[model samples]
Target: MSTGFDREQGEFARGARAAVVYPDLGGSSRDADARLEETAGLALAIGIQVEDRLAFRLRQPKPGTLIGSGQVETLAEAVRDQELQLVVFDASLSAVQQRNLEGALGCKVIDRTGLILEIFGERARTAEGRLQVELAHLDYQAGRLVRSWTHLERQRGGFGFLGGPGETQIEADRRLIRDRMARLRKDLEQVSRTRSLHRERRQRAPWPVIALVGYTNAGKSTLFNRLTGSDVMAENLLFATLDPTLRQIALPGIDKAILSDTVGFVSELPTQLVAAFKATLEEVITADLLIHVRDVSHPDSEAQRDDVEAVLADIGVAETTPRIEAWNKIDLLDEERRAALSAETAQRDGVMAVSAATGQGIEALRTMMAQRLTAGHRRFVVRLDPSDGAGAAWLHQHGEVLDHWVEDDAAFYEIRMAAQDHDRFLARQDR
Candidate 1:
């Protein structure tokens, strides 16, 4: 099967044998074994049958082919022996390196970026999601056009009706890609503007937004469903949820909140995707609270946490934003481990251990969310004419009304709310 289009079908079409290679460049922070395992999981998520997995310690990377000549020959032999249909590299590959490897291996080859793009292309459900994926795909392809099409080098003369010789096929194709990327960017900008307006409306309503973010398959979707009582696509596979999902829920002391389940983050996530999905991730940026879920049972949980934080920092999430760590999947751990983790969480300031599957520690989590939302909020006591039902209802909806009583034909309310909301209320009262 060809690499480009057929690779997109890897997740659904079965029986495609593949080999995975992870080049362990020195001085990397991530564990090579964990990286290899994650890469294998990524391949399996797309339905590729992994026949061989190899990790090479590379002292220096070859220019033409990423791997050395001996490694290439050995891999070639194994590919022929195993009759592998594809080879997937765990690192980004230059177009020339990709072409050279494909020539040597005599089979399809794809790198981490390409594999991720394929998964995104398949998983994106909404129109905006598809547009973003297509835009990223086009941008990635634009850089490799010359390497992809050999016939692009052939000269083409203009018709007699036209003035001069026409642009070469490669130039024409690149121009077309550029134009398409421009249009897609324009469309995405419009979508972003609409999302901003919605965010503004939410701000006026002033229900706190809580966004869930974590590594792929860390049970973010499961936790989201448990918290919101909604069935999102939560599975063991990587990237099961692509499009951001939002639902309204009631929190302790808080009347309502908008809970958002966002696309999972992965290590070395394609730059193209990061740029393309900025509009979608704005939900995370504007959230009053961020719930960072972690698979505590996983061996590389700490490393995964670092990766997620790096991505968040890269996306410009302010360091001052309030965030909580949800140590999910505690059920998978042994009793002693669970007890230790629970104790550790208790000692921590903003961490909670919970199993989304069994409703463990969920109440504590909710309480913590409520506390974080109301932290540093201002308390106000206001007296209103009993006949002014609108003002009473506004206070009830916009703030946490701690107590209310009727006295002297007036409604007296004791409320606690964010300073911003308090200001907004005062502004509205003035008008």
Candidate 2:
């Protein structure tokens, strides 16, 4: 599960039995069992079967094993009795702790960061996605490489004791990793530049870009597909969508708007990933609006929402950016509870209750999106020269033309246009 521990290529074969362990340190906003359940889902996403799942209560962390000795012994017994090939810990582990835990447990061990990195590596489809994953994996591996090494002996080089091994194998490996990471970053910078160019062109195209963001497996892709009619892969698996997807859709009273379906955010997402995927997530950072599709029926929905908000804040998404909380998956709720939730959401200004699966409240959601996106528009009545086809076309493309007619060989248009577009139109008329 650890990225750098992939020396045995097929050691983590599909369907390998594994146990998930979550350290319940207490005072968490979310339940420990839910964390364990999420870890199991992540393991299953990569075809690993979770044979057992447990949350160990720990008031203090042990440097050697993270959990206490007795807890380690109990976990070891489970691994031995079940013949589990792997155990996943739903907490960040130090390199030393990971090494010692594996030694004590007598099996492969991975922590929350490593498990998430594994999922990102498995689900990354595009070349850019693959590169980002590799960069993050290298960053993680570089930190642990020294502690992961078995041989600490100096490789004798140059004249006897004078040189005393200029560089050890572990150091050499780390240098190589650093060099590879540099190259990947350079490549990603190029990708970022290309994406920037595309983004600039989209801005010039003058279409509003709306981004879909939420916790992993929170029905974002389903809502995106429902909105855009694009067949993006939407499954129940965690991290199902790694690459960002975009499609153009028409909204109520809006001709064209770009909708971006982004990779889902997860709790304790690897910081390495956040840094590496910043280029891709720039779309969300620059989005005109964000639609946070949440699994309202999930037990930890509020905590998950907070997790998503934290990631957005980490990525520097502006608090002023307009957001709509799409309380999704209401179909999973019982009728009475769903009704109460619907009523509550109706009273909230920026919230909507929706079931993307059943097509409920989707139209209302669209209307709300249109209203939010066009909230700054002002009505205008502009007259153009009879031969000014370009001016008429520009107005239609950039604004919602409510009515148009020709009288005295002049075309008059009544439109709802943004303040900036209205200014640009006046400038064009003066030109």
Each candidate structure's TM-score, on Cα atoms with residue i matched to residue i, is: 0.91, 0.91
Q: Which stretches of candidate 1 lie over 4 Å from their true place?
A: 1-14, 146-172
> Which digits, one per residue and each the tens of the lDDT, describe model 2 over residues 203-287?
8878999999999999999999999888999998899999999999999888899999999999989999999999999999999
lDDT of each: 0.83, 0.85
Superposition error at 344 for model 1 (Å): 0.6
Cα lDDT tens digits, model 1, 18-120, are 8899988887677788888898898887767898998888999999998999999989998999988788899999989987998898777889988887778
After aligning candidate 1 to the native by TM-score, how far in Å is the CA of 142 from where it should be? Answer: 1.5
Error of 2 at 397 (Å): 1.6
What are the runs in model 2 whose C-alpha is more than 4 Å off? 1-10, 146-172, 405-409
- Alpha carbon lDDT at 252, candidate 2: 87
